[model samples]
Target: MSPIKNPTTFFAYIRRAPFGGRLTQGQIDGVNAILDAWEYFKLTDHRWLANILAQVFHETGGRILPVRETFASTDKAAIANLEKAWKAGKLSSVKTPYWREGWFGRGQIQITHKANYLKLGQRLGVDLVKNPAKTLDPVIGARIAIVGMAEGLFTGKKLGDFFSHNTDDPVGARAIVNGSNKAKLIATYHKAFLDAIEAARGAVDAADALPEAAIADDVKPAESSTVMSLLGGTVGTAGMSALLGVNNPWGFGIAALVLLLGAGAGYMFLSGRWSVNRIKGHA
Candidate 1:
């Protein structure tokens, strides 16, 4: 979770592939809010961040913001829509109409049920039970989405349960929000968001545990002396082939090239550019 220096780069990378090349201020704001929360919380896990973004996209239907369960414009409308669905038998798995009790799904995490509101509210140090709509705020919603998944407050299954250094189970990570419902779909979103986040890196992360070599873009050309040595070697090899009774010119030349330049590059001509490290690798 290193802080990305430029968010615009992130937007640029995922614009066409994941975000479809069209961006709205609301979409940008929603994503930025989540990124801000990630930085503010001092979180360092990219998988956790990516999985959180996936959940946001899934819960908000790519709005990247909080909304009611039915995506209705108003609480009244959301409740009414739920009731309509309930009566129509569309909600076969629902035991009761949770929205009627004023605890319909809200926020990027979309916590439903009254108990979750109270629990998540207490953890967030806010009275969400009293003011449930407050969860609609992007700041609050992002925090809830990030923290809840991190701490396993949603369904007692955490991000760690599915993601770690050795394992990345985006499909299983659906346990952090709901059950295994739509786990594969959410996994697809997770990979997309994760790829975007990685591509968005503007600087080397302090916590990144990778060894790197700084190769100059413009490799230096070989010197005249070096060119003469290679030319001399080729001419010497050709003459030696004849002297040593090597009848086939192609076989002798190929063998010479393989032995002289074989492992990495054998030998490079002066006309080509070269790097010290590349030469070392060849050696």
Candidate 2:
């Protein structure tokens, strides 16, 4: 059996190498809640989880972008205009002279480009072009990213199905994400996705076994008591009496004497004669 079948081992994998970076307690809780929701939504595959993590890590250096004050003012209208520029090809000039062009693609997963943000925001019930900072929230970012991954850029094809369909097409969506070395990146992402699935399966199996395990634990004491009673009945009725005679008669006698003395004192107290004499003398 794979160690991943064990919940403890599976959680150890998560604790050692969680997707996001330097998560606070609250962030970790949020991440766990997201994972639970994903499981509830039947998205429990480790590969998908890891892919999301890698995408976010690659985009935002694993740090959540400040909501209102990272690249510019958190103005919804301004963000919408930026998207309009990207779709119009007016903002194609890499004026910043860095890796990518503009600064609007700022978040955990970097929801870049204006059109994508508008689409994702609409699906996630947020005004992405306006409150771009909402994408920095891990839960919102993960949900939007998942939606985008499942549903392509304004296309109806699921991203996974699309990649599989265009595995041989050099200019496909996969190629756009990974560039010239798209095959290698796709393979890596695919592996991460598979790992996430296996981990999630293990977690489910472990959860299913929990009730049975609890029942077994509860039954153990009863079994132990039965065995003890049998042993005691046999021993007390047979060889134990003989062994007690030989083991230390004097010590047993001393214990009996101590017990008798304790009983005699208790009897005297119960009789209440001393207490009665004191009470009568005081009166």
Candidate 3:
């Protein structure tokens, strides 16, 4: 819920000196937002998310713009059109040079090869050839990448796969992005994945706990009884009654009893008894 407190922790896993001594505030915010979204989508496996982020970091130099160059005035209109089409769900077929040969690969994760783009785009509902710049936008690019990772684009690919073309010596990919420390780059990827996993786990636990809380807060016990009676009366008729009788009558009764107990337990759990203890424990 709170922001990550230590900035160094944020970069702890990076294998090299970040291209800059520190990422700009906008870059940090963008990265955090991307990480948060990955968690939200339940794609936060440390191995996956970290590798993806690391690749992006390696490609973009931790900046969102494909390179330092600003979009020319002529290109501005095209960029705007692309943004509009992206928002409106039109322009499904478009590809930009940037997506093909610019920073990183092209499209989400800067996937450069047209073949790879076509494959990955199918899962993201994009035509990689038609709308490549969509990968340039922080939100869309990251989302597409998360989906690509989910679809196993990165699986079995070595780190060199992402950086070979960028550096003179293919192995220099790690050294270039990581500066003097290749391990830091690997660690950064590892941490990214860990962050994604932890965030997703917290989200899932909260989600699992929510239905009980919502029912406890929004529905009266009487409302539940009314619904149960309606279902039981209709479904518990002759055939059902006979089935229940033939199967274990005791089993049916025990199931009902258990359901009631579980509901009560859920209500209690939502009533904030443990919440107080949780807060206290944290304190």
Candidate 4:
């Protein structure tokens, strides 16, 4: 089963953005781009997907598309602070294009500074140092955001640091991108997205299991203890209680079918066989 059941269903879930605004077509496209990149980049873990999307949504403030950093127009105080740091020699005062030429904070994840841009550009085979405007492109921005976050490029706080099957700290996940800034807010979005994605995942798995279910329906077991033996005496006793309730043959048959399904699902769940092997099959 794929991480997403259907794009429509996924979009429907995404419409519940925290800020309570409608998503534009471009924003939807950007989301699709992000999902595609996740698959392409092999970050298909549902937990990771939920956390990543939450961070992205929080960063963009319900905007569908990845946007360039607007600190120049919106926050002169920050730029002045950076300038002050530069003057004090606490940070490099290199007057590159990104510093003076409006190339600063151009990616969805907002990779700032000329040196960082040059490094990321070299890694991705794009000349961000020369054409820093490319970071504003949604596709490029998605790639940068996806790869950067997953790999812990943002202040060495990788996605793996806070996400795993056994443990998930959505608020702490903010550390993966920006060191506890808006951690709780992003965590709220994370839980919402996680619920949506898990629902979609269950839907996809149920859909995929239909054929197997049909096959099970076709095979009616004999009047023997084989199923009971396989299911163990305790489980078989409980199943028999349900199976023996019906007086009519048709009702009995339906009850038996239900037991068979329950047994199959229980076995799969206990043996850890039900989940799709996404890592093995998908890149």
Candidate 5:
């Protein structure tokens, strides 16, 4: 079981870590969805959660949330080049029509193409084909990111391949999604998130160990039912913003921009824009 089970603590840790700056209500719901998915998938390691959160935080532009698919460029030539790049990479063969119009790269992991969506939809028992945009649904997106990465459904690199009790290679874990495109940057974010998560876990554990009488009536711990209820109910969920589309096939180029949030988060941490001290203030 993860020590950071309480959604409040889990999200607070995220907000404190690097680029995670006050996640929006929808993003909070996304984090909750990930928590539910984590249990459903039976992922046991805290390290895996930390690494996953780091990747997601980067993938969602440091909001520590889920977002609609983004585009790289709207220029005609750039779109043409993007199509060629996808073909060369053998990622898709549908050509320009379906590539340009079909729903592709809709999830947080940027699950691409009609075939892939149908396949994932079958696995999860969700009707992604009829409602392809549901892939961007926070709950569904959480499941995709967690299940896909853990099972190596993406790039043939599973989370277990890089993270375990004996070995921890966050940079190498980038292969679980893309093949080390910004492995070092994601790794840096992973470290900050890991530390923050551990701290939150420790706080929860310590609170649990305390006697009921020791805690003041008004001073509720983050894991307390009161805290959880307050967190879940106070900030109501909202629809995520619409997808920022490009003129070309929604593939790696624009997807790469979203993924670059990993490096952006690192920059936030280094620049002191988001820090442990600041997080405490919010807490």
Candidate 6:
């Protein structure tokens, strides 16, 4: 069972801002997928889960599912429109114009750039390089968003930095994925998500209920036995990288670079690179 005890209350709380007071089936499914990934990983931190939920709320523009850049409906359309934007110089900040190369952002985390694709693909054990569209798969997309931030793959900033037992900074937690573009705004969503998460019943460590001898030596105490059972009894360590690198499109660092390049969208990468943080608030 999910750590979230009261999903009914959780959805009701989110409807206010991120969901804009409504939800489509796709949005609900997206949220469920993320929650499942949470359990699959045997995560028990409510605040961390809330922060992740808040980011997905913002990054997907509330659609909840993995999204294409410019909110395009399909891959061809996303690429076509990105090409147009690049040609018209609307995407001036793109130092490499990665979109033109079919590296346009996709997934809940909106990962862009071929380097990011290759690196994350290696970490997640998916062929995002040869078949980038795999990032759009619900399971894979959820994993990218969660693991990217949880492990600090996007900006080298992990969730614990901002939300441990002694601290809670949703505004700062924004760095876990991107920078501070909508830090305060996401913070609000964070509070709301926290409330809903708190309402949910907490999960007991399924490992505790098992006979000591039945437990596998390789099984970590942190994960519940149920998670292991769901996985048919195994978890790989590939996606748990401690490496911290910057690949976001919406961040100020890249935006400043774009500004130097004349109204650049490199902010596209940081703010969104980490949302598509590719070119947020623009084409």
Best by lDDT: 1
- The whole-model C-alpha lDDT of candidate 4 against the native structure comes to 0.65
- Candidate 1 or 6, higher lDDT? 1
Q: Is candidate 4 or candidate 6 better by TM-score?
A: 6
lDDT tens readout by residue for model 1, 180-277: 88889988888878876876575432232111101111221121221223334444555433323422333433543454454234334343555455
| Cα lDDT computed for each candidate against the true fold | 0.72, 0.44, 0.45, 0.65, 0.62, 0.70
Return the clash pairs for model 1, or none: 1-44, 261-266
| Candidate 6 per-residue C-alpha lDDT over 1-283 given as tens digits, one digit per residue, 9 for 90 to 100 | 3666544445545554456654455676788889988887777778888899889889998777899988999888999998898889997777787887789999998999999999889988889999999988988999898888888998899888888889978899998877888899999888877866665454432222222222222333123242223222212232111111222212322332333343234444556643532556764
In model 1, state the lDDT of residue 228: 26
* Model 2 residue 111 distance off true place after TM-score fit, in angstroms: 1.5
Q: What would the per-residue lDDT of candidate 3 be over residues 245-279, giving only the tens digit for each residue? A: 32232344344445555556666789865444534
lDDT-better candidate, 1 vs 4:
1
Model 2, span 1-283: residue lDDT tens: 2223443223323333433212233333334434543554466434445554444333443332323213445555446656666667876764442212333554444555667678888877788777666776766765765666555543443446533533422124343234333445444544543454465455343432221121112223223222223233433444333333422323433433354455567667888844445445654
Report the number of the highest-TM-score candidate: 1
Worst 10 residues of 4 by lDDT: 209-218
Give one clash count per candidate, in the order shown: 2, 11, 17, 1, 1, 35
lDDT of 5 by residue, 1-283 (tens): 5556444345455554564443345555555667778888877887788788778877877644445445442334434655667768754644553446545466667776677788788889999888877876777888888888888887788999998777889989999987878889998888876765676664443332212211112332323332335323322232011112322212322332343454577778999999875345553
Give me the displacement of residue 33 in model 5, in angstroms: 1.8
Per-candidate TM equals 0.70, 0.44, 0.39, 0.61, 0.62, 0.68
**RMSD over all Cα atoms, model 1:** 17.5
lDDT of 4 by residue, 1-283 (tens): 2487644345545555453434454565667777877777776678788887888887766664666554333334445655666778776545543445444565567888877788778767899888877887888888888888888776788888787777778888898888889999888888877766765564443332221111111223222232333334434767876654454434544666677788889999889988665566665
Which of candidates 1 and 5 is the stronger one according to TM-score?
Answer: 1
